[model samples]
Target: KEPGSGFWLKWLGAPSCQRGSYAFYKSVSSRAQPDGPVQVWRLGEFYFIRCGPQDPVCIAEVTLLWEDQTQRHLLASTRLYFLPEDTPKGRTREHGEDEVLAVSRKMVVRVEDLVRWSCGQPAGWSSSLKLNGLRKPPQSSDSNDKNTTTNTTDKNGPVERQGVKVLSYPQYCRFRSLQRRLQDGARGPGLQDPHLLALGAVRALPNTRVMYCRDTFNHPTLESNTNFSWQFSEYLWSSQQISFRPSACIPFPLFV
Candidate 1:
């Protein structure tokens, strides 16, 4: 969210990222008058935020947290999630209650927008995709470690990870199909996609906001896939993917 000044006023200069807990976000869990054992915001953790009165509670992953030097506050960059019902092809009995479609980019949010940390069993895939280097790297066992492992039972059995993970392997297909679908649904199927306007000629529309997303270019969310780097044009679908592509009415800036 921005103020009426027509430019970003709070985050004035290049910000620095914190290591462990980052700065205090103080979600619903840590709202007590004194300190409590609430989990602080960390990279890769999933959280829920209600952006407005009528906006549905959406879930997202914390990608990065930077402290604005001028205003002395922490702001977050995230990858948004969408529910099965919100997708282009609506929901069905096959979708799990916890299932979601993940996406990235378009805005930087205030840490205050976070409502609560989403901690529970994550939706599973037939053959789990590693999503290896997107956020955390695979851990190698250390020589000093013991062979014993812990078990967490919830009437089902033990699980590996505890939160939602992004699955954007086929996102170019989603984005291209969605762009066509959105146009077809609005103006009938045979219509073409809207014309492309140069960055200078573009104007901010009614519901859009002015954003600066260049800062996160050096982030993992923007990292290129390792496997399909040098492929031919026809085989580019797997390589031409975007990190985040959800089935939600995502608020995006026309000019950013």
Candidate 2:
């Protein structure tokens, strides 16, 4: 584990688990002391290795252990290789300031404002609201006092109350799934939020955004039959199997 020691990174696919008692995997390794600026390695169709000024390289060793009633065993091990020069080491280059487009910056238009303006009621319509730099308008002192009184009344009138709660990461996913459902015209009191209609419109627009999954909703739910620890263990293992990648969704937005 000393600095610059050779290391390994392994990627195992779920399809490989089909082997009755064995697992298949692929890995990349680095030379103990690479002399060049770039080192390249490949394992399978599922990965692309790139070395550039913007990316750093790291290597790790992976181990898998298994235990059974009869004995314990080391299931798998792998090494990963990379080069330090895989990152740029030379003099820096000069760069110019990036140009900003006015239209692109003005993309977020309020639906209500647009409707009123388009209906030829300039007097009734408010100025177009942009999503960027949006802030809630300040409330008047009179309204704040009224809200305080209303809150007091509601606190006294509530039939029952549970503990206050905040959404967890998985619950956020569930909320997004529910939003997708509501967008598809599902009936629910959640539709009472005026902004939900605009959200549904955004989801309905095609080729204009990057979405989590195009065909289905993904949420985390625990099985009632499993023990809490077992359920958590499964969730952790499944989460580790997922790999998130970043790439330009719209490579050339202006040109397109």
Candidate 2 lDDT for residue 110: 15
Q: lDDT tens digits, residues 1-256, model 2?
A: 1222232222322222222232333322222233312111222111111122232321211222111112211122212112222223321233111110111111111111111111111221113211111112123345222111111112234221111111223443554565556447674555543454234222121111111211111112212223224423432342223212111311111110
* Global fold similarity of model 1 (TM-score): 0.35
Model 1 Cα lDDT, one tens digit per residue, 7-98: 22233223232233333221112221233223345444454444444444445666544544355444555666656565445667865443
Weakest 10 consecutive residues of candidate 1 by summed lDDT: 206-215
In TM-score terms, candidate 2 sits at: 0.14
Instruction: List TM-score per model, in order.
Output: 0.35, 0.14
Residue 222 shift from truth in candidate 1, angstroms: 22
Write down the RMSD of all candidates, one decimal each.
20.6, 24.4
Top lDDT model:
1
